[model samples]
Target: MDWDDLRIFLAVARTESLSGAGRRLAMDASTVGRRIARLEAAVGAALFLKTPQGYALTAEGARLVAPSEAAELAATAASEAVRAEAGITGQLRIGAPDGCANYLLPQVARDLCDAHPGLEVQIVALPRVVNLTRREADMAIAVSPPDTGRLMVQRLVDYQLHLAGHRDYLARHPPLRDLADLKGHRMISYIPDMIFDRELDYLSATGMEVAQISSNSVAVQMQAVRAGAGLGIVHDFAIPFAPGLQRILTDRIALRRSFWLIRHADDRASRRLSLLADALAQGIRAEVLRLEGLLGPCPVRGT
Candidate 1:
């Protein structure tokens, strides 16, 4: 039977409705019905029995289900294996959320390009997480370690946020005497929901509830602070990269963030993947140390 027919069969069998399967497959209802009919004719058995409630699989359909799923799994594996064998020659699609891409990716990309001259890198920099199971990206740099099953997870290093402002902004604010003094100032950050929990907690702890100008990009936030718009709690990488921005420390900035390197479970064994992962991990380590130096040294740990 055609693979398309089996694909429709699996979608319909798992979802138990022509419309549901069609939606998942991005096909129209009539098209799904026609394909299912074609599949049933080829198999010489009715796969579904339409009842008032919906469609239910027949005994014969149930028997076919396991093998169909196994076929799909085999196909998926074969595709990945083929791509892996192609080595670093094809595109290495990387998914990165905005913050990591802006403050964290340039060095890594440079290093990867130097190491793997044949490899092409396609960066899918997004403000939100990309779906790996759909092959949206071959690997990703994420703040939260992916819970996606069987993916390889590498904890790169921990990073910190420090309050930062431009020299002129700091001159006017005259150095924060204490955390409570922050109440009267403009504080910049991502939408509170978008910021990691540790940063949000640090903001809340100061009892300063200032409306943040909405920003998804760390680069944008750093620019806002440099323009004297407000004091920003920014990652060390973001601030140092901004040039002339100084840390505003009355006491330690309490927000600690972690970086994670994620790859497709199958990519773990691919030599191209291993090379890229090593390069990224190495770059991240160096950046962490650079950030520490910018912050004038702190008791921080590396990967």
Candidate 2:
């Protein structure tokens, strides 16, 4: 029943590893283990089952998750209420796609930091989905909205992707007049097997079987195309920044993808989250407008 113990338990449950929880909490692994033991003893139940993979929650621990989350929310709300009087101060972690994280989020982070000098922001730019339930990130910019989870999901913006190639590469290769011409050109894209999200399967929409040059990172893929490696699907927002890149088949080949902003349902009540979400949405909207100006509005397609 101690709030501190419940906090420790929640961290361990979310991470499923003592060392992970310890690192997040700034405590050593032994200290985190002892805290978990104390929490289990106080509750008079074995909260976790230790396994080679990590800790698996016991039935009792699973049952406690909801209430623990509620407690955490209430505590956060209380803390935020007090902090509001003095101005917001806390860390906000965002999980974003590589393109957005590298090209977009930095400006957003700067604006957020300038507005609230005490706030800290971290952006994790990875291709994989971030598990909000595990607190991998406070919020995330994802390609698709999650179908199941206690999450607050919203469609942030729709952006375009186009088949792009460097000027030198296009001049060296045969003209790409139609879809069939794609067969003759080298392609750069995400590795088919390494694509973590189905939304990232860009080449498939082009009727291409595979890419000759592949990478898991969109940034890398873009670089490959920029270096005249081959034609690759690049975000419209990113194209303006890369010199000598041209959108190929502008009218024939364009893919529209959406960015969804997601956050843990429990965190919705926190003022910091509310403010951060608003800032993220605004930044994305501005970027989308810029992208639209560069590439024209995304053509509506049937679902």
RMSD of each: 6.6, 3.3
Best by lDDT: 2
Estimate the TM-score of every prediction. 0.68, 0.93
**Candidate 1: tens digits of C-alpha lDDT, residues 1-303:** 898799888888767788988876789989999999999999999999999877899998999877886687677557657776554555677887766777777767777777667677777788676666545677888888865576889999888777777878777764476665677678877777776434234455445675466576676777898898888777777766777777665254547788888887766546656777887788887977786676575323210
Candidate 2 lDDT score relative to the true structure: 0.87
Q: Which ten residues in a row have the lowest lDDT in candidate 2?
A: 294-303
- For residue 63, give model 2's deviation from the true position in Å: 2.2
> Any idea how many clashes model 2 has?
0
After TM-score superposition, the amount by which residue 38's alpha carbon in candidate 1 deviates from its true location, in angstroms, is 11
Candidate 1 Cα outliers beyond 4 Å, as residue runs: 1-87, 193-202, 298-303
The positional error of residue 54 in candidate 1, measured at the CA in angstroms, is 21
List lDDT for all candidates, in order.
Answer: 0.73, 0.87
